[model samples]
Target: MQDALIVLVHGAGIGAVFALIGMSFNVVFNSSGILNFAQGNMLVLGGLFAFLVLPSSPGIGPWFVFLPASALLMAALLAVQGYLTLLPLRSSVEQHSWLITTLAASVIIGAVLLIFQGTAQQTVRSPFPSFWFLGTRVPAPYALSLLLALVWFGLLRWFHTRALTGLAISAIAQDLDAARAAGIRVHRLQILAFAISGLIVGSAGFVAAPVIAIANDSGVSYVLHGFVAAVIGGLGSDLGALVGGLLVGMISMYAAYTYGGEFQDAVSLALLVAVLMGRPEGLFGRPAARRV
Candidate 1:
């Protein structure tokens, strides 16, 4: 019973992280129908950036100062990359083209991180303290991840409800042609969505790396799991992405707990396969209508 409860808590924590990541990916997928393969790279990039900007590292300023600084700077830089790389693709262009382009971008960004950061697996000293709940030990970074998710979701819910820009972006995602007809600047919205999505994904790196050690290839699994989370949750629903990520996270965490840690990847993939085959539309998503 104790082991079960611990498994649950740890799984839930991991799920929370993946949930946020899925939300970030879902935003871009829903907005532009682009897979944004580079999302994982953005996370790794942010992690590497954190390594560079920390006080103990080769950077200036206090550790506290560098955290936010690195976060904001990385987000901004990725936003610019979002603008430059994705904004130009016409919404009418084939999604495959965008997929290829973005996949290439992911490779490029990942390679760059590897080139600079090397293949070392390293840990980041977090600004938060670790805690235990019901005999389940929790890392500070995971706790921080939960807090970030709450704040980000709260802000997103609020913005979507009240902010014109946020609503416009959501509207564009919902009905691009209708949004255009209503005088929403589709191009600008796309640009904005890319930037915001990049920023969100970048922050995933910022917070998550402290919980798990980061490496040159750290991003591949982070992103692959994120895709599973987003797909299983629902490609079109933000809430679905959150739920999906959490589900995937829990599966991997519990699998590793009960089984061997080495089986984590295979278990995660198997779950993804099972979910995809069982329910393609996902838990909260609506199935597409068949053409007559």
Candidate 2:
């Protein structure tokens, strides 16, 4: 029973982070119809920024400062990447240039991080102490990550349903041509989506840094897992991303606990394959109607 509880807590924590990354993917995908492959690197960059800014034993005040600062910086950087990725093309969906541009941006970011941080994995010391949950020692960041996920989801939900700008963003996602035809400023909204996506992942990276090691090479793994989560939950569905992330996190934890750490990724991939085979649109995704 204790083992089960421990697994649940740990899974939820890491899963929350994955869900955030997935939602970030959905944000940009919705507005621009382009998947920013550099999202994972942006997440790592967020953690790197947090590592540089925060001290070994940071206080609450520092967190308040670091979170917004890291998020804003990432937002700006990703916005620029979005601009460059979209600049050479006439239409985002029509050109398919983003595939190369986004990947190149990711590689460039990884190279820069590698050059500066070296190949070693960097750990961020948690400001809060570990607490015992049942028989398991739970880290503070884990709980924090879960809380952040909840807050983020709520805010996003409200933004999409209530806010005027968010409604515009949603309109763009629904139909780019229609949104533009309605004078919604499609280009500006697309850039905003990129910025918002960066903010989501940046904050996630900062919060999850203590749990996941910060390393330049880890971006691929993060992106892969997050992408899986997004797909499993159904792309463009924020709630689905959360559900998918939690499911992935729990299953991976179970695999690790039962077999070994190495089997976690294998289990996740197998789950993805199973889901795709059964439902290509994802568990929560709606199927698009094709015109005959």
Candidate 3:
């Protein structure tokens, strides 16, 4: 029973991280109709920023002072990156340039971090302390991570449903021509998507740094797993991304717990294959309708 509970907590924590990444992916994809492969690196960059700004060891003083500062800096930098990505393709028919641009941006960011942080693994202590709950131990970082995920989810849901800007972005995602005809600033919204992506992933990294060691090469792994979660949840569905992330996290955790850490990737791949084969649109994804 204790083991089961532990698994559940750990899975939830990891799932939240993936869900955060997945949602960031969806935000940009929905708004711009482009997949930013650099989404994952935003998380890495956030961690790196936090590492340099925040204290190497966790404490309330350092966290309170540096967390927001680091996050803002990361967001601004990534927003600039967002602009660079769309600059070249704004008037061109080559819509796929985002693939190269975002990837290149990610490489550049990684290289920059590598130059400063080196190849060493970096770890930080959780800002919050662990506590016991119902006879099981809960790590503070995991709890904080899960809380952040839930909060981000609720806030995003509200934003998309209630905010005018959010609705405009959604409209653009549904039909760029219609949104433009309605006088929606499609270009501005795309930039907003990039900024929001940075915000979400950057905050997530700030919280998740304690749990996962940050390294220069961690971005690609995050991209792969987060992409799988987003794909599994359906491309543009936030709730789908959440569910997919939870499933991926649980599967990976279970495999590690049962077989060994070495088999976690294998299990995740197998599950992705099974899901793709069974439901191409994802578990909660809606099917497209065509009108002749």
Candidate lDDT values, in order: 0.71, 0.88, 0.80
Over 164-225, each residue of candidate 3 has an lDDT whose tens digit, in order, gives 99999889777777888999988888888888887788888887887765887888888878
Error of 3 at 101 (Å): 1.4
Best by TM-score: 2
lDDT of 3: 0.80
Q: In terms of TM-score, which candidate is stronger, 1 or 3?
A: 3
TM-score for each of the candidates: 0.88, 0.97, 0.93
Q: Is candidate 1 or candidate 2 better by TM-score?
A: 2
What clash pairs does model 2 have? Answer: none
Worst 10 residues of 2 by lDDT: 86-95
The candidate that achieves the highest lDDT relative to the unseen native structure: 2
- Clash pairs detected, candidate 3: none
Candidate 2 residue lDDT tens string, 164-204: 99999899888888888899988888898999998999898
The count of residue-pair clashes in candidate 2 stands at 0
Give the range of the ten consecutive residues with the poorest summed lDDT in model 3: 86-95
